[model samples]
Target chain A: MIHPSAKIGKNVVLGQSVVIEENAEIGDDAEIGHHVIIKKDTKIGNRVKVGDLSVLGKTTSKNKKMARKPGAALTPLVIEDDVRIGCNTVLYRNLLLKQGAFVGDLSSIREKVTVGEDSIIGRNVIVETNTVIGSRVTVQTGCYVTADMIIEDDVFLGPCVSTSNDKYMGEGNYPYQGPIIKKGAKVGNNATLLPGITIGEKAIIGAGATVTKDVEAGKTAVGNPARVIK
Target chain B: MIHPSAKIGKNVVLGQSVVIEENAEIGDDAEIGHHVIIKKDTKIGNRVKVGDLSVLGKTTSKNKKMARKPGAALTPLVIEDDVRIGCNTVLYRNLLLKQGAFVGDLSSIREKVTVGEDSIIGRNVIVETNTVIGSRVTVQTGCYVTADMIIEDDVFLGPCVSTSNDKYMGEGNYPYQGPIIKKGAKVGNNATLLPGITIGEKAIIGAGATVTKDVEAGKTAVGNPARVIK
Candidate 1:
């Protein structure tokens, strides 16, 4: 069901059973796949492609058990020109995907997040709320980018990387702060970055490493407790 | 669309937009949620509860880049009595979920896998092809259980754990064999178990540990390369 208030531009192709809510806008040459759901106030720019079963501008659920409460006054979700979203992906309200960004299948991007231009979020990746990802970044499959994280331009995060925001695992009173991955840094597969650490520019973290502290710029860190090897 | 050959027993409740393919069998008192797809020849036992947007008996995809090729002669997926499947989960063909098993939201269980009775496969978890998980096992959220793995009864795996089956990461000709997690074992959060290792019964693996070798029964292992600490 396409709402009467929804705006669809010329030459746009919509598949079977697609739902466009009130005030949602789809630009020219955009293609929406089967069973895709676009919530109210979503803005999709020109030449955008959304795969089957994707949900855009979804609202976050708040429960009593949740440690972090989501913001109430979220704005409309914005997807700039040439953005591509794969099947079964979920993008929350107040999120912004810059031009030419690609989000692969089964991913979940939370609210207030900004993904810069030309970035790639691979399959099954989870980008939590309040994170900012810069341009030309590549986050591979099955990774967890915690809330309040900062990933600069040209950063490459390998598959299954785990980043933590809470040091006390919901037991302590400390503030939640995820890692800061600087520009051009590369994190290897299955690596774990503890809370509040900063990976300097062009630094390398080896596979299966458990990083406990800040890494120096242009250095390589390996093994548990991740000391600089170079 | 429910196929003419499909059999829905007494007291079955099917939600809107559901698709039940040819020869599918749904037993008595079964409750199927919205937008669910039950493929051909799939068998759902008595009192089973399936949540929204789930796909059962899905076929596997094979490509040239894939290291492991799926079996050709796959059979129908079978879900035993009282099994509960959460929202957006996908279960492949040739799979079996025994009585009372719970599969959480957004999880993917591949073909030829068997999950025994009363086990819990948590949210966003990935259980690759050909893995057998025994009864009462707890695999927490965001963990990756690689292909060809064996997990015994009462095992506990924490969130974001990673288990690998390929030692060479698709480069070498070595046979793929994931870790064997024995009965009552406990693996903590963000732990990485390397290929082919055996975690013995009642063993405890610490958080963020990189396990390179086998862990003995009744022991505790921690840190990178995971030495026995107890």
Candidate 2:
């Protein structure tokens, strides 16, 4: 059932059993495939395409305790014009995707995250809450982005790159801090980053490296406890 | 559509557009989410909760020769009572989950596997074929379990733990033999286990450690090419 409060624009096509919740707005020339769920207060701009079984604007609070934190209302999601969301992706509440952004299949983007214009999130990528991804960034498949991350413009993260937040593994009081990938930097596949480290501009991290510290600008880091080289 | 020959018990809650194939049986008080697919001859027990978009009873055969070995009919999946299966998890055929087992969100359990009673398989975990997990095993999120593993009781694997059965990485004639994790052992997050190694009883593998050899019983192993530290 399409709710009465939903505002669907002209030339929009919705496939079989798609659910558009109350107060959701879809702009002109949008295509929503089968079994997609557009939750309440979501706004989709013109010429957007959402693939099959993708869910938009679901509420995410990390855990039950955080969800029950006082004064937490459901946040709104915004997707600008010319965006493409692939199959089975889940974008949580407070997500903002600028124009020309692309999100691939089976990805999960958490709450309060923004994908700047023309960014690309590949298949099976998981971006947690409060992460800011800047324009023209590319995060490849199977990469895990922890919460509170900052990926600046034109950065490239290879497939299966895993980042962590807590070094102590809940044993002690360790503040959660995600990695910082600066502009034009590139991280190779299967590289692991420890908490709170900074990858400087144009830095390169080799495959299978375990980065335990910050990588300086214009340098290359490789091997375990990654050191600067080349 | 639920198949006519399928047996659904009392007080079962099925969401919109769930598909239950022929001869599938769902026990009492089970909650099946939207777009979930339960294939033929699969048996689910009482009070089970299957989250949205999860697919049950598909078949997987990783070995090319075994998959080409003909005369294999569709295998069956058996889930005992009071189990909780999270969102988007996929369980292949020839699988068995004991009573009170909990499977977290987005996990993929391949064929011919048995998870013991009261065990917890965390989110995004991939347990390949022919794996046997003992009771009360805790495998945390994003861990990758290779084919043909034996995990004993009371074993705790932290998040992002990776295990492999083929050390040559599909290059040499490395015979497939997965790691043997003994009883009461603990493996910290991001630890990589090489092929065929035995982690002894009560052994502790530290976080980010790479296990390249057998770990002695009750010892603590840490670092790449993991050596006994304590």
Candidate 3:
């Protein structure tokens, strides 16, 4: 049941049992699939396609103190024009998925995150809060994009990539921080990026590597500790 | 809508908008959550709990030729007594989740799989086709249990554990055979196990390790190619 306050534009196709809450706005030509839930205050742009069972504008109670801020619902979810969200994806509040961005099935994009235009967040991926992904970035299936990370333009992350946000692990509820994946960098499948490191421009991290430190520009890093091979 | 052929036992509590397909049976005192879909030939045992949006008896088209085998529906999805299926989970047909088994949210278990009694399949975990998990096993969040794998009793797999099939890396589709995690083995977070390798009884695989070879019984392995540390 769509609330009386929802502003659904022309040619919007809502599948079986799509729920649009109060104050939600769906742009023209948007297709929301079966069992989808658009929470209160979500703003979906034109030509957007949200697949079956996707949920947008999920609450950020896990953020603890950040969620208790005054007027939390005032900041709505912004899914820009031509974005494509796959089946069973979940998006939290205050995220901006820019033009032509594609999020794959079963992925989770948490709050305060920005998915750049033409970027691909593939199937089963997780982009935590406070992260920024640049244009045309391809984070493949099952990759875990840690919080507070910056993935620059033209980056390619292969399947099952893992990233960490804390140095001493989560012993102290420490602030999140992670590696900066520079422009045109390529991280191979199943690579693990340690906290606070940086992958230089055009660098390549081989598959199954555990990156311990920073990699220089135009270098190829492989194996555990991930030293530059070239 | 409950199909005419579906047998819903007394005291079964189905939440709003639950769909029970043809030949599906929900045993006594089973609780099904809202928007849950139980497909054809599914059998939910007594006291079973299925969370919201979960789908049971999904087709095994991804199993390729195996899906066309005779009597596919005859080996119906069986959730034994006191089983728990978490939210957004997808369980394929011909799988048997034994009594007291608990599957966490967003997990996917494919066809012909048998999860033994009291096993825990954690959140976001994917257990591929034809795998057998023994009793009291704990496969934590984000663990990928590949096809044709065997995880024996008392095995513990930590978060983000990745297991691969095909030693030649899908060169021939390779028949999909992965490691056998023996009894009482413990695999730490983000560890990758190579194809056909056996994790011996009481063995330990450390975090971020890329295991190329098998670890002997009572051994502790760490690092890339995962040599014995203890």
Candidate 4:
């Protein structure tokens, strides 16, 4: 059901059973797959390709026990030109995807997040709320980007990397703050980054390492409670 | 689009845009959500609840680089009574889910897999092909259960646990063999289980541990290349 107030641009292709809510705007040459849902007031730019069953501009579901509280009203989600969204992906409201951003299958991007241009979020990745990922970043399959995190430009995160934002695991004493991965930092597969740490510029974290502290610039860290290797 | 050959039992609730292919069977009191696709010859038992955008009895997608090859024709998927499947989940063909099993949202279960009674597969979990998850097992959120694995009854895997089946990734030289987690074993959050290891009964793997070898029965393992603790 396309709402009468929704604006569809020239050459837009909508598949079967697509729901475009009120005031949603789809730019020229946009391709929306079957069963896609675009919520109210979402703005999708030209040449965006949304795969089947993708849900865009969805509202957040929060419980009372959560430390962070959302505001009364959130801004609409914005998608720039040449963005590619895979099947069964869920992108929440108040998010921004710059040009050429790619979200893979079964991924979830929460609200208040911004993904810069040419960024790649691989399959089954979970990017939590209030995170900022810079351009040319590559987050591989099954990685978890925690809430309130900052990933700078040219960062590479391998598959199954787990980032934590809470040190106390819901005790609510410590404030939630995920790691700050600086430019050109590379985290290997199955690595764990503890809360509130900083991965310095061009640093490398080895596979299966558990990082508990800040890593120095241009250094390599490996093992549990990761230590710098010469 | 319900096919003419599909068999729907009494009091089954189907949502909008649901697609049931030929020879598919839905038992009594089953609740199928919107945009759910049940492929040909799939069988869903009584009181099953399938959430929106789910795909059941899907075929496997294999490239030439994959080590294992699927058979010419696979059998239908079977879900027993009272099973619950969450939104955006995908279950491949030739699989079986016993009574009262729960598959959380955005999960993916590959073909030739068997999940025993009352097993809980949490959100964004991936169970690869040829895996056998026994009765009452609990695999927590964002876990990766590798192919050819054997997880026995009552095993508890915490959040973000990663398992591997290949010694050399994508080499195709080594035989794929994932970890064999024995009955009632408990693996903590962010743990990494290396290929072909055996986790003995009631063993405990500490959080953020990288397990390299077999863990003894009723023991506790911690740290990278995890050693037995007192």
Best by DockQ: 2
Q: Which candidate wins on lDDT?
A: 4
* lDDT digits (tens) for residues B16-51 of candidate 3: 988788999999999999988788889999999999
Residue-by-residue lDDT tens digits, candidate 2, A1-230: 68999999999999999888899999999999999978889999999999998878866422221212333675799999999999988787789999999999988787779999999999988787788999999999988787778999999999988877666543437767788999999999988777799999999999978888899999999987678889
Worst 10 residues of 2 chain A by lDDT: A61-70
Q: Alpha carbon lDDT of residue A112, candidate 1?
A: 86
Computed on C-alphas against the true complex, the DockQ of each candidate is 0.13, 0.20, 0.14, 0.16
lDDT of 4 by residue, B118-142 (tens): 8888778999998999998888678
| Angstrom error at residue B20, model 4 | 1.0
Model 1 lDDT on a 0 to 1 scale: 0.88
User: Each candidate's chain A: what TM-score?
Assistant: 0.98, 0.95, 0.94, 0.98
In terms of lDDT, model 2 sits at 0.85
lDDT-wise, the better of 1 and 2 is: 1
C-alpha positional error of residue B133 in candidate 3 after TM-score superposition, expressed in Å: 3.9
TM-score, candidate 1, is 0.71
TM-score of each: 0.71, 0.84, 0.71, 0.72
TM-score value, chain A, candidate 1: 0.98
Highest TM-score: which candidate? Answer: 2
Q: Write the per-residue lDDT of candidate 2 for residues B90-151, one digit (tens) a residue.
A: 99888999988888667899877899988888667899888899998887667899887999
**Candidate order (TM-score):** 2, 4, 1, 3
